[model samples]
Target: MRYVREFKGFAGIRLESDDIGTADDPSIILLHGFGQTRKIWEDVAVGLEQAGRHVINVDLRGHGGSDWPSDARYDFDAYVEDLRAVLGQMRTRPVVVAAMHSGWIATAALAEDAATLASGLILVDPQSESGAQSVRACAEELSASVGQGLAKPDYDERLLDIFDVDGSGARLLDSAPHINIPVLVVRGALGSGHRAENSTGYADAFPNAEAINVDGGGLLVNAERTEAFNGLLIDFLERKQPRFIPEYRSGSDARTLRDAMGCFATGITIITAHDADGKPIGLTANSFTSVSLDPPLLLVCIANNAGSAETLRSAQSFAVNVLQIGQQPVSNLFAGKGEDRFAGTRWEVGEYGAPILPSSLGIFECTRNALHEAGDHFLLVGKVEKASFEPRRDPLLYFRGKYRRLHFT
Candidate 1:
């Protein structure tokens, strides 16, 4: 269950938050980064609640549902004080989870008395310091993550002008030693560049802290590697701030098992072929691999209940279109229901008479070689008749049930 709750922040500002789960359960306060709202934590909140934690997903002073100050006081101190006030208003000391820029606020808020204000702290893709260039890069990333055409931007625009990113980093480093609580720092691919050394130093400043770097994960770790992040979060919570001990029996939870399997990352592909009537049929799939090189063989596992499964299984020829980063919409269209996937996409017939996406990173036109039933899915093996690829493009990636892009850091 989720309810809207309001809290008093610095100077009596109304901070809006989604109060989820039972109040009796241990509480978790979620804070999003700059240019992002509490909506980012919607999925993470549900996951935390399911793992027996009460979640309070909140909006900062000038973002989302929270009150935007008339005077435009978007400085670092204002944010820190707002968080401190929110903690003071809470009935229970909750484990505070902050991401990116908000991590600095959370750190400063709990610096003086972390034990009294919060149980534990978790920072996602945090940076201890930032310069003007870093701030601009963050804004650019936020725009790219949604789309280049986002017209109405979230949060008060004054924030960018008012907050001193360069000074905030140095102040956060000064405050880190004062915060002596259990801390977990999660770094993504973005952490490898300008913030790598500084983030490591920040995490080490904590008296009791551990850090984990996620490979191929972007700055938005919770959004990209959600399942993996949740797993790490819950595990950290259980170990550091245990309320009740729970043991998991093997094969007990299907969700747990599925989440475990999601850790193994794979590249996205679209399996395309024509039906008996010569109509194009395709579906998005990540269950693909190169089987052998001697005879040039490959295989893709299709679920038995898929709409195109039967057609693909008996098709004399088929094509695997390895998607690039720009083809996420195409992947979603093929994976969805009641859509003319081919009509919306630009594709052409391959040399082997199989439909192929013209803009794909790679294309494998093949003829049916073998088929094998494997539980709920069947493996369709094919002899590669022709293979074409574009070396300049980066392949689309999938991990932890979310679309990913190759991030070279």
Candidate 2:
């Protein structure tokens, strides 16, 4: 059975998505390219559902039934944040399947938190980080191809704004290495956006990734070669192990389990709140994810040993500032023991009375709603009161015991 659903995206924009197949089945999330809506994945979703897989097709912000913000922010980070919000609401971590520009969004989102967000990744004819000129040329070509009748009424001309934005290039080169999950890169033989060299580079970057070219297929390989694409997808799914799940058994080595959990890549964040004395307190945390949309809730986990844990737990409000690629030092400073973290860091009090770090990829000013003790950490749930972001910066990442930056192809 198939059903339509709507979810709140970053900044409270409503996103239209379709859910197909049995709820208990393995899930595959499909993302369409620029200027396209979820409709593009209809055929592919049907095929996957027939194979006993649950398929979800989503219309990115400013397309289809989704709301287009007045800010006209159609940059890469906006798309990535939108996907992150959608994934947060899913009952199961899905295998993300993306096309062209959407592939970059998938890569960024997976890079942020692959363990909780996605099981596997499939990138089809994804745009290469070939530079601004190449992106503009591709966008122009796509705009022309859409013509007039083919375009959706809700399609904003600003959807092509990504071409002019800096840092719009795919960060797969840097992010792939951190993504320990299986990845499949599919390119059409004559695809304009994907070049053989770029595909090779992607495969080379990922420790567990492969590239495939579909014969006689063009940009929309899944549509042009539906049967072939479906066959390949099914084959890849069969070969990949089921999604990784943390197994805690009696007598399991705690250190060994911690090492295993580190395999999941995550983006860095500096969670800040004011203490009872009105002193600002902040600490670096990667255990953060959106929890609900009805009330706009998100949660971050703070270890019991963290110096700021008590402050955050008791504060009426806090902010989660997602670190940018240039904020490694800031992450380190907050992560370290005894030094004035905010003394040298550039920051200002947000409207919600939480410290807002400058140049962060995104910021969530939230009101602390609930706190629960889980193991040795405290789960602080917050109802987001304000949200903002920087469109031109890539996220700082942590994976496998090291800091990493996005490598634009």
Candidate 3:
């Protein structure tokens, strides 16, 4: 739930992301029910991502940030069209997931693009016509629990809010046949008696689908029973995968060394200084190591091809600013090739003519003690002219090649 989140979408139609973790394996796309915003699935998405499945929370048209139809009638086809446009904007073509009312609609559209749209599909708790009586019963049972606290609505209100339709029976019957994929129809265990029956009817309608029951769930199963639902969805998506996009970096030329470094965890440091003529020179480096604690000797390596390498190599002194785990933008700027790399960066001069980045986990103002040639890089050793360190913040890491934070806390 505390996952780092962001809002991104068109026409102010907000899309939310809570990266529980990276998606090295399975990716997921989550769709919310009608009248509900994308926030409904935020908790679930974070849980799935933390479990290693890439999860995205989708906002339906006229619901979240998606543009609303000037016309009052918000139907299934309009919802599907919104997804088509949204998918086109996604960084990755995600596995579509529809909860309850959205389940049937998303399934149909995805099946149409089945070949290239997704690596898998996760059909969350959805209602079906064949199971209307059961769902009705389940609805009634749930009505008993929060009847005093919440303003319980009638069947018509429930149907209209969830399916964007006034009627429930005909709607359920028509929607069931639309879902023909290997669906997982999840039902809340604490739901009305009719819900269980409707879920069974739904399972019977879809030949490739299975029915899973999550205890203490209700109409808003994805939100109320988020943990259970997320677990089931992640498990299902991971069970099988299609190599729609075999590589994370599409072409060989676009593959970054950082993607490969994600395998080996390493520490972070920023090396800065002045060249022979006294102009400022610097770059962020994660390949920093302590040579000797006795004399407090340290070393930072710079790649020969790096833009600041020449200036740093010829300098008489340089400062080592060991960064904390969360300084992503700072690392990006220093590692990037741009004229205004330090435009927004906060830094100050050390005793040695070198720039010392603010709030670094540790700062070592040093004079060039030694330089050793490493393959394609130079290891520059520095004798501590001045030193400083902080305890609370953890050291940053550069593994396999991307900047990663220590997640122990």
RMSD of each: 9.4, 21.6, 8.7
Return the lDDT, model 3, position 365: 93
Cα lDDT for residue 74, candidate 3: 47
Q: What is the TM-score of each candidate against the true structure?
A: 0.57, 0.54, 0.54
Worst 10 residues of 3 by lDDT: 146-155
Where in model 3 is the C-alpha error above 4 Å? 1-30, 38-94, 104-120, 127-180, 185-239, 243-258, 262-268, 274-280, 289-299, 310-317, 324-355, 365-371, 381-387, 391-409
Residue pairs with colliding backbones in model 1 are none
- Model 2, 294-341: lDDT tens digits are 899999999998888779878999999999988999999999988998
Best-to-worst TM-score order: 1, 3, 2
* Superposed model 2: Cα runs more than 4 Å off: 131-140, 143-154, 162-165, 189-198, 217-224, 241-409
Writing each residue's lDDT as its tens digit, candidate 3 over 1-409 gives 2344444333334444444445454556777654455665666766675555666665555554544545433455555555655666656656777765566566656645553665455555565544433333434444554333335332233334433433544544454454444666676622332343535556766546666767663444434555656667767766555434324554464354444545567777778887677666778787778898767788987889988888878888899888887777778878777657556778888877788887888889998888999988999998888888999988777765556667521
Q: What is the C-alpha lDDT profile of model 1 across 109-216, one tens digit per residue?
A: 999999999999998878656342454466557555632233655788778777768777777878888888899988762232334443455588788888876655
In model 3, how many backbone clashes occur?
22
Worst 10 residues of 1 by lDDT: 189-198
**In model 1, what lDDT does residue 166 have?**
72
Q: Rate the local accuracy (lDDT) of all candidates.
A: 0.84, 0.79, 0.62
Error of 1 at 407 (Å): 26
Point to the candidate with the largest TM-score: 1
> What shift in Å separates residue 219 of candidate 3 from its native position after superposition?
13
Question: Positional deviation of 102 in candidate 1, in angstroms?
Answer: 0.8
